[model samples]
Target: MTDELRTTMERVGERFNLGEYEIDAYLAVLEHGELTASEIAAETDIPQPRVYDTVRSLSDRGLVELRESRPMKIVAVDPGDAFGDIRSSLAEMVDELEARYTAPARDTEAVSLVKSRSTILRYLEEIVADAEYELALSLTPDLLRRFRDSLEERVAAGVSVELLVTPASRAPSPEEFDYESVATEARARRGITTPVIAVADGEYSIYATQDALRDDRDRYGVIFNRSALGFLVSGFYGTVLWTTAETLATDGESRPFPRTYASIRRAVKDVHELSGEFHVEVRGRDVATGNEIHLEGPVLAHEFDASEQVASFSVAGEDGDPVSVGGLVAALEDVEAQEIVLDRS
Candidate 1:
């Protein structure tokens, strides 16, 4: 903090920070080019007694010039000249402030609630940009469009993105939108009941109602980062909102194995569409023992519930018996998979 810099900042602060009367008087004189104290009081709401003090304050700030003629005129100084020093000082001050700034640690919290719309939007963008492999999102049409460019970039970088836009009626038709550029697959759900969600690489996620993204007083979004609890959000998206969505577009582009998944339902869906024997490596926890388990073998069978919300696969275990694997909090299966990797047998 040099003395000169400190003085310049103080001068700038004094110059632009104005009271109501001073602002009114300054603008009145600027608008009329020049005006007497009587004219200024008549043109603005500043009372006659306070008009002299207001104009004098403006003059001291170098915003206006005072003429020593009869009636004492107040003249507006060209704003370009008046504000040049202030602008320069502001730029310098901002540089100094930025130098001292420490970014808030985003990964320190496991779960957080955010209320501001801008903050929610920022988190949405951050999650989208941060995804390295798989990304799943449930968004409104406007939010889809807002982040389409970033999504497209991720797709181009070989990141698989599955997008769900709701309510289905408001989503763009295949003819009007190029879904392939932004998503590996894109779908539309029939109602606004689908919450706005973004999951990045299965670990970081955000969830909020459609109302939370809108301009309303009561709104909130939840953020999950580096937490085991994040799987709950991804599971809900895959089994709940995603299964009910009607496919709007799919590239049908086959990605080479080994592919990884955070959602078992998605992994099962892809395996169901395959032709022959495929191998899988499951990183998960035993349902009964609550202990970590890793299983790798040729996939024997895959199952889906009537609604297709629940999905699991059977693989030969250590004793040559089939083990059933489900996603997230898997109570009905032998193991709850946190990540599933697939490849050729």
Candidate 2:
């Protein structure tokens, strides 16, 4: 190989350092367009064991196509055509990611009402695990007891967990929930649960209601996710959470919680544009320490990006200016940081 060719090879490797193996394979195909693994090995002087690996990687990255012609050839894609495919693939990926993270429900009208217990449980698990922080739930004594182990795992992950148990559920003092049990379970797992709604981490809220939820395989569970209906369920049954063993533990007389209707007139304006989006609302850390801070929000209206290092962010604001998401994340991490000062362009 000539000096210029060597330099280009090095540059190709450098450019694709992040993507690694695939890009190297693509470069190999570019230099020797029609070659089998053995041909690639011989031309590139790569080890025999790695020849197949490189050829497969190149094919996987869509840089080279394998064919069954005269010599079992591998053809390199045209530069312009190859790049167009990559760009299109990335665009589709971003769309799918945004849908899962930003928009929870879509394209379900014709999928048949998924009312099966197994399906409901699976959906509930997906929604629950995706929660960024905090999970507010209301369940009877029977239900909580069943999910006790799972809740303990969530609480231990530095997540705030607040649960209210009605006094009437147990006549004889309800088995004091084991703190040791809580701690031990937490030690064995990685999870997080928030204390309550104090500037909640994630916007979407998940709730489940069942007379008796058990580990039994035969039983079915009903779990549904909805911002509009959840707002109502949570608002109306606020007492189920407020009347804890602590509140009624000291109340002059136990009383049933009154229905909540404070937010009855609230309207849920559809944020349709938010479909399939991931938003990182970067702020600053404490000014004194100059640490980094980052907050991720499920958003459709925001276009945001930040580098790995807490340097700066690029987000289009109401006015259309380039702002730094990483910079903002750092600013918010600072103790003195204030309202999300977005970079508006």
Tens digit of lDDT per residue, candidate 2, span 1-345? 446445544544443343444555567778876677667766665776876666666666566788876666778988777567445555555565465565445333312233354554444445444443344444344434655676667544433333443323341232465633322111111111111111112223333334113333333333333443344344433323332223222211111111111111100011121223333343445455666444434322422222112222244444554433322223432222222322112
Model 1 is weakest, by summed lDDT over 10 consecutive residues, at: 251-260
Error of 2 at 48 (Å): 75
Best by lDDT: 1
Q: Candidate 2, 144: how far from true, in Å? A: 2.3
Candidate 1 per-residue lDDT over residues 28-138, each given as its tens digit: 888999999999989999889999899999999999999999979999999999998788889988898788789889988899999988889999999999998789999
lDDT of 2 at 9: 49
Query: Looking at candidate 1, what is the lDDT of residue 90?
Result: 91
Give each model's whole-structure lDDT: 0.89, 0.39
lDDT of 1 at 145: 93
Candidate 1: segments with Cα more than 4 A from true spot: 1-86
How well does candidate 2 match the true structure in TM-score terms? Answer: 0.29
